[model samples]
Target: MEDFYPSRISEKPQIMKRRDPVIHTDRKHDHEAPLTKDQLDFYEENGFLQIENLFSDKEVAAMQKAIFELQESNSCVQSEKMIREPNSNEIRSIFAVDQDDDYFKDIAADQRLLDIVNHLLGSDVYVHQSRINYKPGFSGKEFNWHSDFETWHTEDGMPRMRALSMSIALSDNYVHNGPLMLVPGSHKYYVSCIGATPEDNYKESLKTQKVGVPDNDSLKWLVDQGGGLSVATGKAGTITIFESNTMHASTSNMTPYPRNNLFMVYNSVENKLVEPFAGAGERPEYIAVRKTTEPLGKEKILK
Candidate 1:
């Protein structure tokens, strides 16, 4: 309901989009295939990988249509997981679509996605969370520099950093449209808060709908050691996979172009969650799933 601005951005200048080598051209695949040795090595060393044109134009269109329809429907409005922009009424995010509709559920269980997750996380992975982010033109705000595991560990009670997130571009992510940026090789170090503890930070996230950001010194050190920043940008079908502990951020979309992406977090079945933080039990099923070990089926494959 309120405009949530990160403390770090108060004094900082407008976040600039970096032009690094975060987009991959050679690793593209159409069907379900395991990651190549080079892809694995890159992911291991850098903590992130980007594959271009992994999904077909037709498949992206179908998912995009579903998203638009759902956004307009009354069901999505009542779901309470549909987050709005800080100031405007435009929809910013829709969480846990798998539980609401069959289209997203099939997409969630697609073998093409599962195969890649298996390669990175080994077999027996379950969906920890799934959502579609809408970075509407001129209004989408910046996501601050933060590790997803920090929130998952502190708020959702995730035991370890055995999870990873896959972001599928439903709309083209251009440099001007707030494409995700990551500091390569930053996953090796779990940067603890210089200010708030994990629990206290989780409370802030609940109020603001944004994660706790890394301090200025920590961000500078990470950029210096991790080989600088790289932005993920590509066509609608491109997919970006990153480790849960990777330090990542995105700037505000100032251009007229809107960027939309489907984000899914997959966790190893062995590393289930515990309710450590207060009010964790009351969290919705769509935001934090309770099911475990349900590997997605091979019903929907992108051609």
Candidate 2:
């Protein structure tokens, strides 16, 4: 494969470091007591945790309606493409909803969510990436395992910086329904430079040692080494949060029902959006629907 590694963001003087304009360090929203000592300890130890009932039944219902609408529109578009291209990687569609829309504004600004974010990050955290995953008809597709930072752009030697993602299910999640699988506490072992080879074809060379076995064997060994894959399963309103460095992916949805989930990515104000990857055009809906109450710098909000 051709080398596709992205160039690093240009660095500036040490005295005046440049940061992502979209990230803001201001705590505009009212913050309750951030993370209690126990909550912090819990996150530090476990790579992931489940926050049950993040959304109410009503909210979930509304989201379900919106998701179906989006899916219907997507199906029509893909169907047309199918006429020309018989083979396409477009087996499924995962959309980033409008961040500035009523759904996102309400959910992103939900005091409960803000409280949890404040707990994980400090009071001045910013909502970075918010998207919806819509898999139709038990598609035999999965989100391949990868680290978020690998796809990001930043000055060399920059800190990992606090980041978190909340995956909220809009339908009952199960192994068959493609519940997310996470390796426990794996983030602690992550290194910043996970072998900076070609971007798209980059394998996670950051492993401490070579995984000598075959794919299934290595996965089994990994499960044994990391206490096993955490299959987060639950009802529509449950949300699971984890560190950005945590290793995670999902299996093919095999159930008759569709699997839909919303993802909200959060990062500190200092993290810059790596253009072409994290910028608005990559997913315009995500950038446009963002509704922040406080000063968040020059973020690419999806309105």
Candidate 3:
């Protein structure tokens, strides 16, 4: 198999210097708080954490309304990042929502989220990407098993797996609605995939309406090392944070209920992407962000 390369493969700087981790002590925001000992321990041991009811109903509803409006609008750029569902024309994912709208931008900078991310990363964080995934009832496609860091590192020029993903369910994530499934503690094994490259995977996803998955051998090895697969199911406000290297996937939504989730990826400021893989110019600002380390202020938080 040919070695996989990110979309844009110019002879630019391909690697970045990994930054040393440092504990952030200054908590300038009211919502900012350090993670408890148990919470930290659990994340370190399992590579993920599920925090129930992290957002209030009003907050969730407001975001849902915004997403619905975006979906209803016909003007959203139909880029590869804003992918459509396999069979139907409905959008399956909306990438870089933070850059596209103010409401999502604030959510991306929420102190409640940054505090935990800051603690885990032991340094300042920047939004690498923000997206809203729409798993429409009965029509939602499957997301094949894969590790996020693999793509970020190989395609986006992210130096290491110091980033993490936070997913907030906009609708109740039930087992029947194709909730995300993760392999516990799989972050320990950074499986170098051999099959489709990131660019090919994106093309195939557009064609098949499914995420590009890992090879069968890698999948089996990850499951064996991580113990098994676990589903993430919870109320609308529940939040889940997973390490960048964790292997995760979701099944097709066969039920009539929809599962919508907001996903944000925060990368350590010190580990910014070198160059986008997509092409000559920068990848769309909404897909892979230009690195900025300025911390989010309290004023950015939504009430």
Candidate 4:
């Protein structure tokens, strides 16, 4: 239709040929096996854990290509601050889809991811929501400290609610390259200082800032109380698992490169969504999956 995303014609291929870790990595079976008793305890106690080199080089290539294609077409919206729109024009951004893609389809069948979720929430889990994020150099914004569950928590203190999250880094992320950050064990608190007022919107207020390198007192408190700004730095294709209540955020893209990643959320079958900031009662683009008949493996089914 109309040219929404400003097209940049470059001699370089649209999708980088060699699969730059700076851009994407391949999906692979990770060493971070489904949680042992120790890992489960660690997760319970710490709120988050890391899986190194979870994706292979090839998988990263395909995912990166797909994301770049999406970016070129303006299917994503990019901004420095958090402002919700039905659609956006930014190259590096997230999308709500009614259809499935190869990447997500593969993610849907990933046993290891399911196994971890099962350990935490139980086997009868469903894909509550998924987001594709591309953080481009100089333009990518910061996602401040917050919890996903608090943003859309159902009433009645539902058990096994949005239980867990799987975040895959599509590209090599370094401290300067704007990696994700988290507050260890913060999820156990079950509270999120989500900005209720316009000024309180962390994304809006801290648009032009970086995490891990705090410049103010509030930020210093956040860094100190937690791991004191633990950078989610890792090789390309790393996947991190965290409780849904985990307080996490990402640094700003200060370097001249971009950081692209995807975040997927799964809810226990019994849980439903209740949007806190419905914004004039407009429904956000979130979809639920049907309960599948496939066996979720013993590892996934919580005892």
Candidate 5:
């Protein structure tokens, strides 16, 4: 497959039009929780969809407890799966949450999520990455603006924009806190950032990303093109699904409220990863799964 979306190999940033669809699915499904037609239209036009109160209070509480347990667990705190803040011992993110605990694993395999993923990608999907992000009060840092597809293609070798992000709010995301902000229609374009990929870049980028980030001019242009930026603010149990190429970021939390988000990124089975488009060695399995390309379930649905 060709590298349709390339990044981090030039001295000047390149703004290229996206050649992929925002929503890849087009078929009937028995998914009780499938996105409605209006929701599908919204995503195709805006690159994101937010559904409030999708999960129940009980489910949200359960996940919250699981997160606290994982945070207190010695194994997560002592392992490489944990990503700390730049200087402090604060846990910025816990990678591969689905692999770490049965609670997360069950949530990952939940039929509603799986069915919706199937409807979105038009195929059975597998988890490309999973993590729980924590932004403690007064200490959470910002995530700079960038497209996940750009990094995935350049570093992780995701050949196409057939992937999407499914993030559930584990805590109330407020304006005062570092809630996610996304460009409304940013997935229509790709930003080819200017930088050289350093060796073991994931080690640093997993905490703070410098390379593959959109430049100021490019961000301005995208905002103009997208109409404006939209903040994802919702109570716990709110669910958001966005295109993989959507331009999104978060601010540094200075408020007393902590914002925690659980991410389960799904990729089309047909769009499985390959060698890095930047011509480097593959990243670790924990960052990007390469060994297992199996479909979400035992077999492909909607085939």
Candidate 6:
């Protein structure tokens, strides 16, 4: 495969102008999408959009309940899907969460969210990845700044920058509780990192990523270009949507409050997986999601 955004083989980082389109569709007035022209325009300029209350309080409560049940069930504790904090047993993330949980599956298929994704991708989309991230007070760790597409493209064989992540806050995300921080226009530039991916890196990288991280210079450049960092902090039920290549990260939860969010990646059906650009090979299905590419809500769910 031709590698437009190559990494993991170079000894230095390179910044390449983004070659792919950020907005795949021209029809901005999507009835079910609920995004106005101004909102779409902002996303086009910034590569991310933060909606204050996309989900209702009742809906947020139900989502929180579902997550509580999942945690109690210990379904992912023994599997690779569950990523624990470096210092504690508390889970940092649960990968491929909807594969076994019907509640999350329904959330993934929910028309209210899918419409916006469909409009953005300009095509029917499928669940490329899904997870719930937990940041417990005091023990939680920092997720260093990096672009998710950097890892997904190199290790997971995601072809183009045609994917986007939709993260819905499940609890109050305060400025001090390690709220998500993103560089507004950073998605337009792809930072190719320097490092060879270790074999079976997923086992370790899930907790603290080392291979696909951007260098400090590149991060600073993005920040400088964007003027400063923009944070996503709001009450439960808020939604933050961003392009796959957008630079984002969160700090450790040092305060008493906790931050939890449900993250789902929607990939255009046209931009499917290929051979891995780096690493041992294709990552496990839990992380990259190759088996089930069926469009959510429209086609039959692949088992």
lDDT of 6 at 191: 96
lDDT of 5: 0.85
How far off is residue 206 in model 4, in Å? 13
Kindly list the per-residue Cα lDDT of model 4 for residues 21-63, writing each as its tens digit. 1101112322333655565556666677778755678877877
lDDT of 2 by residue, 1-303 (tens): 111222222221111111221112233422334444454555666667787765678888988887667556565564311111112444233333434356665666677776666555553456666666666544535666644543432211113446678888887887777778887755554322322233322122221112111134334444576787778888887888887656677676777877777778766544434334222133232331233424233333321
Give every collision pair in model 1. none
Number of clashing pairs per prediction, in order = 0, 15, 3, 9, 0, 0
Give the per-residue lDDT digits (tens) of candidate 1, residues 1-303.
Answer: 111111222343222222122212133431234777777778878889998767788898988887778777843465467777668777778888776778888887788777777656654678899888888788888878888876676556666667889998888888878999999987777655433333334334632534346667877888898878989998887899998888998888899988998889988776677763322343556667876446666532222
Model 3 regions lying over 4 Å from their true place: 1-33, 75-81, 195-201, 205-212, 275-283, 291-293, 298-303
Write candidate 3's Cα lDDT for 22-128 as tens digits.
Answer: 22233333144467666666776678989976777889889889888887773466566677776777888888887777889989888888878876765678888
Between candidates 1 and 2, the one scoring higher on lDDT is: 1
What local distance difference test score does each model get?
A: 0.71, 0.51, 0.71, 0.52, 0.85, 0.86
Task: Report the number of the highest-lDDT candidate.
Answer: 6
Better of 2 and 6 by TM-score: 6
Badly placed stretches (over 4 Å) of model 5 are 27-33
Sort every candidate by lDDT, greatest first.
6, 5, 3, 1, 4, 2
What is the per-residue lDDT of model 5 for residues 1-303, given as tens digits with 9 covering 90 to 100?
Answer: 777887887899989998976666643432433777788878888999999877889989989888877887744447788988886888878898887678887888788788778877877888899999888889999989989888889899899989999999999999879999999999999999998888888888877889888999999999999889999999988998989999999999999999998999999988998889983678888789877667766446855
TM-score of each: 0.81, 0.65, 0.81, 0.67, 0.95, 0.95
- Over all chains combined, what TM-score does candidate 6 have? 0.95
Model 2 is weakest, by summed lDDT over 10 consecutive residues, at 13-22
Clashing pairs in 5: none
Error of 5 at 293 (Å): 2.5
